[model samples]
Target: MSFSALPKIGMGTFRLKGNDARDAVKSALSLGYRHIDTAQAYENEAEVGDGIVSSGIPRREIFLTTKVWHDKLRASDLINSLHDSLTRLKTDHVDLALIHWPSPNDEVPMSEYLGALRDAQREGLATHIGISNFTCSQMDQAKDILGDTPIFTNQVEVHPFLNNRKVIEHARQLGIPVTGYMPLAVGKVMEDDTLIRIGAEHNASAAQIALAWTISKGVTPIPSSTRPKHQKDNLDALKIRLSKEEIAAIDQLDRNERIANPEFAPRWD
Candidate 1:
């Protein structure tokens, strides 16, 4: 599946909550953002649903996505949790549904969770199925479980500071798209001199440079923002293209510093 057709930029709703979450989604929608990413753990699916409803845009035109939390991986629980997420999002189906994280410690077989996701697709609860925070080996196992069912994308942390080159390359080799979750590194890359220097050439902000870098590397970027200006600024990354030389220069900024590592996250190294 070619990711060229997917929205190169998306709005990520990670830390935003309650009215703030609703307002941010609304603002992003108003600013021409068609893709919105959320999760069960975010605690704002309902608010995001409100934003979609309030936008007055047809549901079909908006590409809505949400994730299933790790703790709710049982086949029955997975189905129920997805239904709850759908109810909260005020949508019958999501464009894409992902296994929030690959909880290796959890005894549930990979087939069990992926099988439930495939069943969700069969039941028309989701249009696409994917795995997040999954290693290459885990992705291989998921592919085996999914069989012919298309695994739309693999969501992972890909930013200038933490360039996941190997994972991205592996997904590319297998024809799976990689969606970069923390393309801005939670505001850390914004202060990097390498990104700043590169951004100067394009007259773009470091955040924009980092986002553009991700896209240039063939990964879709979802940068979360509650501010209107920031939302529009992220969209501007699509307008700025980094040259090969600049791309390599910024690629050197990879320090392997990850911002979203919860104690439960898989070891990427």
Candidate 2:
């Protein structure tokens, strides 16, 4: 349940669906992406698996992750859902498995749902355990349920705009890595003059600069794209280190601009 060696740069497959999703995954692998993120809700685990297969990369070398849908929080149902996902993903085991969301109102108790995830680890379906879209308190509750099992990460939306400073700080204090989804804030980075200026200095795109900023803050950014150049540009950020002043300037752009929020998502206080 610990990810001491999880890749810092990974591909996020949230909105990528169908052939577009498949092509994106294949392109990312071709571009040297060793980590991939997908979920049952994304409806593209199969395509992701296809991309891995097409790339001819051995399954063990890629850090594959998938999630159990929010509706399948019951103990047995969650385990079964992961099994189905594994089948579609064409992999026997996932490097990481996360609870898609903290379904506070799900039929099962939090303990049961988290316990089911632990069971998945015991059965060798998933190697690590984590959660997504969880608020600070919800993460605490999840940890309580998990007990000694290490929670690998808490994947949440974090961009220069919607900083989620409180949650990020809390997670840092607890030593749990925060994986920043939508790190570019859905193209909002393109409009940020400060980030653009910094990118210009580094000869990188604003998207790359924003992604670098995420890693600078010790959070892993999972930016999704189907374009080969864009994906390659994203990976390039890992090599560019932003100066302290640049990091501070980008941090000043925080305006609570969150891009993804479903009606059922937990409200971040």
Candidate 3:
């Protein structure tokens, strides 16, 4: 499928485990979510696969994404781990496979691992390949390495609180898509009075307003929910058309907050 064919709303599987993971996937599928995101680091691909099976959604109808963890970015290790991920996912190939995080301390060169990722696409292990948690410089390095090969999307922490404008702009400049992870700011958006007021005006929840705001910025938001109500609510967020003033109001909510930063994360642009 074309990169532009990617769904506007995706169900994320971060921090979701066991029944929480399985049922959430099922609920999301039932609620018309065709994109599902998970990572090898998430340690629930088997459950996610089970949930997909239980949902009775045809595998061809779903856009599934899985990631290779940082520790496994070595070329051979990446290929091996992806094979293992496909085994766990009970699928021959994922719709997209990502480098979960950049090599910690650059122990593994981007060229080695990213080339292997491209090889996987050539081998039909992944329909598309991408990078996650990559900085602007890292993205440039990826471009230098991949050349004509496209990096499908840069999956990064993005929300009203952390608009991630720098990376988003760089990715867009390179003709890459930006997939916003943690689009709700990890529940903080629900407490923001501005979001609540906006939600009230639209008869929606604060979470829905935040999601709608995120989408308005031309980034795809993958908001996860174990509850069917919230899944439906988030899917419904796409229908919301924020006025220019409302978009500006939410734009003011950017505080440079980033939720997915780890000690080994690269220096931001």
Model 3 ranges with Cα > 4 A deviation: 1-4
lDDT of 1 at 163: 95
lDDT agreement with native, every candidate: 0.89, 0.88, 0.91
Candidate 2 — worst ten consecutive residues by lDDT sum? 1-10
Total clashes for model 3? 0
Which stretches in model 2 have alpha-carbon errors above 4 Å? 1-3
- In terms of TM-score, how similar is model 2 to the real structure? 0.96
**Residue 77 in model 3: shift from native, Å?**
0.6
Each prediction's TM-score against the native? 0.97, 0.96, 0.98
lDDT of 2 by residue, 198-232 (tens): 99999999999999999988888888998999999
Give the distance in Å from residue 226's predicted Cα in candidate 1 to where it truly belongs: 0.9
Clashes of each: 0, 0, 0
lDDT of 2 at 140: 86
Q: Tell me how far the alpha carbon of residue 131 in candidate 1 is from the true structure, in angstroms, after superposition.
A: 0.7
RMSD of each: 1.9, 1.6, 1.1
- Give the CA lDDT, 0 to 100, for residue 81 in model 1: 98
